[model samples]
Target: MASPVKLYVYDLSNGIARQMSLQLTGRQIDGIWHTSVVVFGKEIFYGQGISITNPGRSHHGRPLQIIDMGETALDEQTFTEYLHEIRQHYTADKYHLLDFNCNSFTNDCVGFLTGGSIPAWIKDLPTDFLSTPFGAALRPTIDAMYRRPTPGQIPAPSPRDPQSASSLLQSVANRAAGSSSTNGYLPTPAATPLQATASVASPLQLCTNPHTLNSLFRTHRAVTVFFTSQTCPPCKMVEPVFERLAEDKASEGVAFAKVDMGVGLGGEVARAWNVRVTPTFLFFLDGNKVHELKGVDAPELRTQVDLLIYQAFPPHPHTSLNLSSIRSISLDPILFPQVPAFQTAQSKLDGFIDASSSMDAKQKAKCKQTLASPVIPFLQSRFATKINPNIPQSRVHAVCSEWNKVTATLVDALPTAELFPIVDMWRLAILDEAVANWCATGSASGSSPIHMLLDKAVSAIASSDTTAVPRNFLLTTLRMLANGFSHVTLARTLIDGRSAATPNKTASTRQNLTSVLVATLLHTDAPVRTAAASVAFNVAAHCQKPLIDAQRNGRRGVSVKIDDAEGDWEVEMVSAVVEAIGRETQSEDVVHRLTASLAFILHLSPYYEVQLKPLLDVLQARVILLAKWKGGNGGLGEQGLSKKDVRRLVEEVARNLCP
Candidate 1:
């Protein structure tokens, strides 16, 4: 059976706490004291109010109640070490009378030991007192009496040194032996030893043995070894910076390790690596040394470490495809010119109302008003003209304002048939270079009238039920947005929003719009899938360019921060593209988009090769079969690509995986 953990409650004022509280708030309180966690008859406490001592008698009086806090998983020594780490941050010098006092320490210790917190009433007592009027008034006087001690008066406990494996094991053994003498409580049986794993959790692992160093290099895709010595001043200066870099790059499949040249096994490893300098950095890929840097240049060190990971996974060939070529492959907008069919439909509708058909007069009037409205003509004119980047900002605002009014009027009045045409017109408008440029340079506030109008129009149109609007209309709109996204400035404005940290209404709406587009790829329609793939491709291609360029230029990693959603957008887009390919493999347009998207993602970050390997393997096998069939005068498979293009794209991506 496991030993029960106990909470030792002590009254600091020796049971006169109610009188002290009455003076402060005119209310009797339970107690004004401190608390600690005691397990196996050892009294473990924190803060300046309580001293480290044996149980039964101490500066603070004996327990008012010894509440059992259930059993704990940690051994006594491990629990003590955990408390030591907490003490480094919550030292006596950093204590507060109310905010971070003795109670706070007890709460943290109890939670860590048994996975449960102390009673809420006790934990919240100080806060509750501070909330009251009289208690608040007496806070300052009370706080001054218990303020943290000045330096040299009561020295803070020193942090524990990083222990070696043997030393740590010995310490645990010593604690176990000492605990056997504790009163009444018996130590639990030793836990089964866990198998050693080469997963480094700290920002920097001090590798003192060849086995440990080898394990890290083998387990991780990329490892950076920092060779340093205790006597080297430069190494000390660069140590903190290197540790910070390790933390920043931890999620990027990079492992950081250090070896001290003055140490035993670390010295042997340093000699083997041919380290002539104290602050040498050796970057390893797949357990082999690939790059070496010597000296204490912090910026260069960060760049080289990032470069190591980048080199390990070189960009995909598709990522480097000419932007011009991608644009060429994209479908042109479905123009809605005033053709004979539209004219005939309008004439019939008018005649039907005039000849006293079943249609009501009011409905016919609405149809006539929608047809005669100058909105379509204005939209046509706007689409036809080349958007002048030199146009005054005010004039641009004026144009968008007029269009906003036109969209609102149409959305409120037009029936499904009438609205479909307007949606098509709006789709064409998004492709205009002038509109893209204007939106790119619009107000950073995200509250610009033009942006608001565009968001409202997109949400009103795209978010409507599928039965309410033509599916083709929604797909076409997505295609237009995808085409616009090819423009880097426009893509950034749409995806990242005005403020990267906090997304505004327009950004949130765009996120919703993007999610809708991604969801549409799962639809039964091939064309919808095709359009969604294009949107993903264009956005990924444009957004990933800067990150790829940064890596090429030997800069730190690039990140996208759009509201609460932060991560590698390149990876997300690649996955989405792969998913689309898996859903529908027969459409040529869809295949083209997926091919380009995969290439772009590979080009941007080759690290995703692990995640994309299965897809790549399937694609390669198909490409091989297709090439053999074409070469032997056989018919092409219905997998949506010509033999030549499929083979080339597949081969390009495969080249990046080569050693």
Candidate 2:
């Protein structure tokens, strides 16, 4: 159930700033604004860092005002997950008093929860204060008070530091009654124990204490430590090299840490590890000390680190191949961006609407009105212009509403065979982000007009035995689904049943978009098969992005994010693309696209070894792709790739499978 989200507004000055602000700053400021988002029985705020407390029970006491910020559709678990991701950006060290304080945090939360911001007064208070001469004069002093050390160049906040910002902020707001700091993170609600949030761990961690170092050892499979002292000149020389190597290995389930033997609890750690020397390196594999070295040797360091990575993640067999061509190939998705002429598409659609005896008089009138002013004009003006014409949001909303109404009515009135013209028009319109996001939201809830229409087309194909579904209908539907990937939200929806409207955990790819794309991969028509290949490529690209990003950032292993939400669809998609490629012999375009999609699905993918490799071997992907590459020997009937580039690509894919 959706719960009400409220903004708990507090006057940090306890009304003193309101009365004294005119004299102090020469401006009539109402109050020193501090805000917390109150939602799901938790009062969430960011000061030293993101903190959750029982509503209205934090040190701030009663709120000056509680503003209703409408209901949040995000369930507690999802919201908690969002908090986990967002907290990285709101760490205690990143906090600023005049900028990015409690109010900034609340603004982001309100925007996510309700698609609106915290009131202008609360959000604009910092700007209002900074505008006055007195405030401008105080900016430097305030900034200096909140300045943080350069990131990754210092030790973690020492537990012994009693004057932490969280305590200081609390004391200042509470009139200096007392001070307290207890790690800044309190227990979250029991109902949603999101202890494990999806966030990239910092490449370099400063180990000020044994506790932090132990935590790293517990969580990571491999941990690399650089032990140094302030007095060690060699430590300074090798610091940059260690940091760089840490960044390169960070994403490979390796945690890199640095400890200063002379500072805080670092002395205890050094003594415990029996490291009497400065600039020592210790490598731990699975919490056990595996190797130790004492030196500033860069080459040896690099060698040992590479050896550690190899032990952690064995290289894929495909990595041993000598295919320079495949490595050079771009993994970017092949998107269908050609927008068919809007007028002709609309004209074709209008004929269907006019001829539909099933469409009511009121429905026909609504469709015509929608097309004349908003829908057709919006598309023509938006796409025709070289420069983006700054169309107002009101007009965008009008187009979205009208498009939804007309499309929903048409889907109901027109038969599946006659739906191609309208579906084609939709394929073009969804290239716009706003319309695509709307359609994605509707798809998640099973209410979108485009979603409903695509379902009808898929149903027609399923019910038919032989080429009964119209070719145009299949082509248009596949193209529309391909265009759905133009926006990230819609792409995720099409790939894994995730949408902006709701988080449907039970959402699967066995049916819906995946089923349609898999079935149409071997469609009788070449154009339909090509279009299906495009859709399959988009899906592969979505799954491939994180893995590629990890590898590019110098991480090891293909990433399986949050345990692979699509379940068995990764195997299903690869199997379908391999089957489709084997049968496609007519169009070079089809083979090239199908080959690209297959390569993307297989490249740097975790599914390859455990699932896809066996499947590829069983299906004899090597033979099929090689047949395309080699062609019939000496004027045989076999049609081989005529394009050198396509043949090279096919050879590369085949070599990886059977090399």
Candidate 3:
């Protein structure tokens, strides 16, 4: 089901910016815009990091504009997972007012949910403000105010002004009605004293001693020093330029520093570097001075800074490719959240508990008691509605608590083979956010019930023949794992191999997941194949999301370093998925997902040419896909390879593997 998405737009200045922007920034700005994506009863915004609150309940209060961003096809669970994945990139420390702020987050979220962007005026306000001369002059002060700190704080909105949307609107109307009385003039807001700067050293450092300068050179990959004198007119002209460049290149591993030649120890440092003139720029690479430029030539200085960055950090070859199609791939994790009939699931599980000879009388009684608990009834009513905006969160926690207790008892007493029904019930319950979070984070003792249950299933599959494992049990396990992606923590636990209970069992968890994944991908049942494809797609999406984000950042001349742990399973997963693709000639949906997974693991991947490339070539992946493309329905009528979207995806994967 689709949910309507709304963009709540607030002005940081409340009503002050509209009135006083021209006087302050010399521009007729509407307001200092702030935006949040309001959907699923949550106002998701980025400020002190990505946060969620009841709609219109944030500290920013009511929005000045409520733009309808249309609808999102994602259900609450899937969308929550998407947010969990994206939250890593939008941390509090990474927030920037001009570059990556609240509006930036809204734009990204709106694009993900509705495939649309926020209105241009709200997003372009920063650029417009910076274009003005006054705004340009105030850029340093603005950066200092918004820059990340050991203890950074965005100034609180004024309490003297009413915070409600209606009150703010009324004040604006009152001002508009009385415009003629004051010749259309509005009072400028009183200036507040600037707060102390951040405890963390700025990228634009000030060095008064050789030791400090030498330490900076050793720490950063590339360093640029601006040697200036207070008495030099050219030095004054370029100081602001140097500071702006420092702000821009700070994230790129290049440090910028200013040395005042007329200040303490400045003369000694100048002579140490053999600087003959003020406004001299010295470029250092790997702690060695590589290039020098003199005078206040701003354009040349900019060029030299970029050149030094390039020399220190060469561009990844994948960044140069026009792989827009790959970049356009959806980063949303595929989840299977179908809830089964509670009565039916309970009856089936009771049958298993009754038939189990391994279970003693006490165990059987306890299991049946758990089945009769309020947890099942609560879940039945919880997912009864398509979108229950008013579902009591307290009720959710209560049900989750009951289930957690029962799960711990069942896992200890019952056999692994008979626990599919219990696992299935937990999977259905996980559709609720509270249950998902509980299962993801695990118990207070730091044990993951979901991980343990899934591990037992994997072991069962591994020990028994594929044909011997019950079809329903295998399907239930696959679906259970797929639904585990609902919470970001569980998603990480599954992919990154970090077990809550056994942190050292990282390799075991990863191997168990892959073992089950690879086994199920080739299962005889069509439903099992479909379920496996969804699981594969989720893992593949996880693998490629960081790479895709890096590619996007690269386009903006900023590089985001992905963790090595992110790609640890890429090569192995790709091999398993490609082999599954060759075998998946039956289901169109399965084939499409498999090919999409292949494209994801291959596209913009750092190991493409080095590792995955050779493996794909050896597998004859291009030939295999080409055969599928040619054989199916005369290239258009085939089931798996005939559809336009499927054909396009296969072609993309084939092209990626082309020698």
Candidate 4:
């Protein structure tokens, strides 16, 4: 279902990373969806997502969570945003196992967990968004565990190795092993137990217990003490506010601890500080009182209080630490920073990516070479920080948005089949990320620009020059479109509350679209057939009901499923075609289309599997249905045809069958 339709590639590479990505995107017979197969060099990185139930409850002696995502999803969206979030808490130097959605550890993640809510301000949310929190929490935990190398994963070369080949190499290896000093987790070298006291101390601080200080500093300055608490509502509000100042504005060596003064209040430490006010602000020098903010809550209170404390104790030594508690404080929330326009950058890029036929052989060769080195690598790095905390949400949006623009230029500029393999790969990658982002944020999101991406996919498929575009890319695009159409149909019904599912304004628009989708089911090209089969299945499965129902009720509402008494016409058509595909599976062309089409189904669905059943059964059902529509297989005076005529037609067709 991915752009290139990599089936045997998994068996080809042993690289751990590739193994991991493949595992995330594909599925095994046991029903696990392979999100990614991460390969670095020849060592493939892969992990199977197992769902753990009653997490602490043990069956044999192992901890577990249920691998719910393995069940199946209609499709996996681009996991770039997920990856960005993961990269921030952890690191991805080389050894990251990315799910196809770009999540490094999204084994069992799904709709609710992956994000499918509208903005918080919207009053009513779709009921489908119910499962987000459990999924979101599980994802982070999986990533944490995934980040932990296999028990005996060969140790990364030590950072302290003086003769190491490259500090850069060590950094890369350290990142692969999750040894990030900057991320929240501490970087502990192998074989070294954590020394809590020494570890918590500032780089220059000694491991001595409280009340101990260097004799050199003791003679120069006095230590200041400040008190705070975690539970105190006001205390919680001002915690970051105070930590920022303790390291910055204390103007002298400040030592502070947040006392728990709510349910468990007034501990021994409270008595020592002479607790008075709820947020009793204090200032001390040399363990002696200097001043007190009986009540200090003003704009930039840290500045006002520190100056007063300093004036009271002029003999103290130290300068402000200039700490940042928040990224940026705004006087007015309405006026925020703006994202820069990328028009100029786009123009430069556009010149390079112009249409394929216009370019010479030299240019085509350059385009192909650049696709791997620059375009592909960029996509890899761009999504590499799937879990990066450093990148802001807006910046992330900007990056994905720019990608769409760049891809548009590429599609507009280049148009050849040699580029087809990579083109479709990028196409699926972009759409996957887009869907993931859309579900996660409840906003229509994407890793690459959606419009540009569709343009490229469509262009490749429509290319008249056989050599200009890969037939595979065209077919793949068709499959993705089918699935995408179904997704949007569901989204519209659930998220937008709309009635129409397909492209046309009229319900009968199916006649035109259905023909287009079905033509590809018998595609001449192998990969083309594969791709076409997928899209045709999804589109027909979801949108064909109107045609089928129209045959019965003449545009009136028909109750097919229990709760969908008022459902649309397309559902019936999809159900009918599904029935059709199942019946025709014995034919090689039909079976290929039918089986490959399952990739776009709500994976693991009962109806999904039936989409590929042998043709005899389906042909039998079709004859019955046609008899009902035409009165009988043999024409009657009023009730119409009888079954005998239909049976005769089928026998003739079957006699001439390829088999």
Candidate 5:
């Protein structure tokens, strides 16, 4: 066995990843990363490089998989097969490992991959179900695997769909933390008393990256993924709640992940799930299919998960105490494409659009009718138009009213931020061809018709008015621009040094635009702040900067904030902003608004995650910052130390950034 190596990962959700490169050789790298954190721990993480840097991708990737290859006659063969044939070349590897106590897990997988044709008696039960061969075969193996006890030191039965991974992980973390700090070896996971709100649904897998997604599937069980982008306003709305839930249950065997779909991670994944909107949530169970819940801030969705879990693990099972072991199979074959089908919402927009001039007059007429379905009016009746699509822009400007009306009329199934089709429309509307004709007369007096249409969308979102317009609509536009490189061919002649003109925003430009939009979104009023909170799940989409600067400057950066000094005020605005950025960023980006924004997010993150990795980085940085507030980098510690006390030291850092 390779000597067990413990690699501790700090939080680097922000721009800090820009320069990070995490590489591993056969025997030297063993690690753990805490994404939803801002605090520090004692574990040390080393890489061949200076740091881990990943420029955010256009689309988010899959979750971190935890595959356990239980004991078997050919355990090493099976394990090696999985690595060599099943999971190869998949990058962005936060984790990958082989588990020796996976007897139950392996047999279950064999059953699934072999199409569930295992013996009838062992057909449907979990491997842990006693009185069954599969279960009995692995009992000894389960005994050897490390496990934690509850207060009374009781070992958990076995791994299954965890109700609260956050809480579960917290227990392990606390114990591990305690032992590691003093002696460096955690005891074991406990059979923790199930303690949590009844409605906290277990998270499922949802990564947009194909390689990562594929790799994750090969490793983990019961996972949930939050796939979002800067263009997805609804993703933002649903983020905080998801993060809180994930944080609350991290140790419970459940993993909550946020993937940037814009990076081309999941290719055809969005389409497979019929993901017409942003902030889509997909759940998985040991590679076998689970469920998908769309939209953000959804009360109905939570109910669905609650029902599903009950079905999977009934409170009272009268059927059989010795549940049979069903083959562990994979549902991914049906869920994703090999390289990821990079279908844009535009692809789903066939026939309804007038992109062709070759259609017969009748076909054109039908297309127009299809585009302007009366259904639009029917749908809009339920959701009154806050911004009329008719103010005159492009065909889509007129068409958006129809789409918006229908979507609004129906139940909001996903976060407003992640509605890709809507984002595409917004993107199209802003094109010069779409908006050129409608502008009363500014940049497009003589411009094409599309330019005029875009103006309306731009004008509406840019307005100080934060009413019925979903935040996703605006964020989508920004995301389109931030990751706009994919459509670089769409660029018009460069007119200025700061901004480039383009027919449409593509995945490449998202990075550049993410920061600006984040700032713009933050600058709104109180109601807007509340609106942000309602859909704050967007943070799961991955668009935050630092909360404070590192320059020992007077203050932190000016991150775009959701204005919430009133109402749920801090809940969405102040707190959401802080959580969004965390404490990771470039040295420069770390200052001013970016830094301030990060500080705010950590302060607002659920208390459980307050001391998470991202926050910890800042805490560590502040330790140095305070040591030299007046002394410059701790050389003359006491002098600057007296200038500001410890608690005040941290606050001083925050005040400077926020101010």
Candidate 6:
């Protein structure tokens, strides 16, 4: 049977709790009460500290309500671990009467267990109470009273006790601190137990053996060792401060560690590092010992550690350049020849909408009745026919125009599920036109009506709840734009400042397009990754083509003039493309697109040498290794590109560029 999760609410005052509510809100309420969650029949509560108490034994009156929070995914062990982590963060020092309190803890537990938060009404009670004049006046007294521990409350478990919850919590905390040992401190039984509540200390791995210590130096970007003995007075004084530094710099990829020289293997490791002093510090970069310090100098230790991190991973210095080849590229919407089936769908949709809008009260009622059944199904059949490739261009154009009109009307009218099929059908039609070479760049004067309609539809779908619109539909539409629409055209439209009539609007539209494409690159879906990579490839290829041509024609000094308004469009484009490539290097489905993108960057290397070095640096080793691999010679797999083809391309690019 599934474990039951219940929220036990209690009254926090003497007399009837309803009296206090009546005075505060002019209505009878259950009373101002503390809350706890009872999971598996054990009442767990968070206060000044986490504690367990007998059910209904506390001064806080009987629970006013027990909210059933449904079944939990957590088993006993996982639930214990969950509570341990909570204890680390929701410690006595961190608790606040108004903000971080029992209600907050309950909300967190419920969210973790069931993926659903506690009711807003219950969670917001404190805030609501505090907002009132009576609440504000009594805040000081209430806070002081809340901080006191109730009699007979069970103390938080001890970390020294092997079977206790604190030990479990400490083991978890030590891992975050970078310590790998189950017995984190020195194996000496006399060693003082580290407090469980001291989670703010930097992740310091307690090194018991040389192999573990050696691994830390190799795995981390940088490692700092705090060599100290239990007997050293100064070392003991500065230990907490050093821990604080470790915690602060943990995310910066620096591993902080401590070796207790008073005991066992730590003493041996300290001697190996030539530690003559009781407290010594060693800093390593890329597995090489780079710096050392002695004594309890906290400030110097912090400074040297900061310097080590900076040296390990220096910031990228972006270079600016203006390439005439990229400037000459066209920015226009790719317009495809209309399809007959699309026109039919559009015509039918227009008539239905017109009929619905123009109908009298009774007629409208009849139209509404038919909207889902006949009207929608008929539109779906008509739209699906647009995917037929045998249709003539002229007929296709007429159909596409009609379909575009119908889609615009259906954007707000149809449910997301119904609208997704139509949008996907439209995408397939665009993809078909792209394959046929019928889609070509149009005038840069204004946005394409079809593009605008599709964009509107996408915006509406994206803004809706995830349950309403399927993720695949969104990915497919994005993929369609990436494959069918030329990035060169889009980039040119964005950078072209000559059209002064509506620059702001033009820029906004271009930015929206760029934002969507960039965001799509980070999606977890493999198909979405492949499609987004294709879009990045197009953008990179277009930007690089001009530079390649300029170099080929021997016009080394020829530069394209860009207005300050265009700013770093070239840089941003390259960054986005490079980022996409970096993210998808290991993705099997996107190998072709990744290689194509890299090839463009390699081709443009001479023109944007300084700016493109980082891209080269990242891909150099992987490309060389992949190029040398003699993989199976298969024709295109499901992703439509052979591994052999990708390998050859990477080799060709590397051979020409790296040399």
Task: Give one clash count per candidate, in the order shown.
Answer: 3, 0, 0, 93, 172, 14
Please give the ranking of all candidate structures by TM-score, highest first, separated by commas. 3, 2, 1, 6, 4, 5
Off by over 4 Å in 4: 1-374, 380-398, 413-422, 431-435, 438-470, 479-516, 536-659
Q: For model 6, give the RMSD to the true fold.
A: 21.8
When 5 and 6 are scored with lDDT, the better candidate is 6
lDDT of 5 at 481: 37
> What C-alpha lDDT, on a 0 to 100 scale, does residue 324 get in candidate 2?
68
TM-score of every prediction relative to native: 0.40, 0.64, 0.64, 0.29, 0.22, 0.34
Top model number, lDDT = 2
> What's the lDDT for all of these models?
0.53, 0.69, 0.67, 0.33, 0.32, 0.51
192-237 in candidate 3: lDDT tens per residue?
3112112122456555546557656655678999998768998878
Greater-TM-score candidate between 1 and 3: 3
Residue 295 lDDT in model 6?
88
Q: Write the per-residue lDDT of candidate 5 for residues 432-543, one digit (tens) a residue.
A: 3223112112222123222222233344555544344455554444433322211111221111012113445331222223333344444343322332322222232122
- Please give, for residues 1-659, the per-residue lDDT of candidate 1 as tens digits: 46678888765444544433432333345575567778756776655322345675554545877887888877877665555434333444434445455665566667556656776667667655654434544444334433423311212212431122123223322221122222232122233211110111233554654655765665566899999887999997887788777767764657788777664356778877788888999999889898898888998998988788787654454445543333233322222232223445446545544554444567556555655454344454454446633545356545655554544544444443444444454455545555554545542445432344334435554667544445655564565566556344455556555432235343453564455555666667777776777666666666555555454554442332222233344435545555565545456556555656666555544454454455446445344333322432322343324556655554444344321
Instruction: Give me the overall lDDT of model 4.
Output: 0.33
The better-scoring model by TM-score among 4 and 5 is: 4
Tens-place lDDT per residue, model 6, 1-659, is 46888888764443344433432322234544467778865776665456555554433436777888889867877777656534544555444445455665676667556656566666667646654334544454444432334211223443532232223223322221221212111112233334311332234665643644775665566888888776799997777777777767765657787777753356668778888786888999888889999888888988998898777744312112233323233333223223235445445544544555434556434434444444344334444455533545455455444444445456545443444445545455544432112222221223333354335534654586423445655565565565454332233332231222235544444454555566666666776666667666655555455455545454332223334433344445545654564455346546556556655554444434454555446645344434333332221223322465555555554444443
Q: What tens-digit string does per-residue lDDT give for candidate 4 at 1-659?
A: 32211100111112332222212211111111122211111111122112112222222122112222222222233332322222322222212221211122222122212222112111111111111222222333323433344411323333532222223223322332331112122222233221211111211111011222222123223333334443456754654465565444322434433333321222434565576555666544545556665343634457544554445333201112121211011111011111112233333333544544666667555554554444444444444436523434354445444444444445555554333443344444433333334322321122223333344444444554433445644554554444344233222222212112223323222333343444444445655554555555545334333223332232211112223322322333344444544334223344433422322221212232223223324445344333332443321223532344333333222232101
Better of 4 and 6 by TM-score: 6
| N/CA/C clash count, model 6 | 14
Candidate 2 lDDT over 266-380, as tens digits, reads 6778988998898999998878888898989988887878777787676655566666665666755566667677788778877888899998888888897788777877877
Residue-level lDDT for 574 in candidate 1: 48
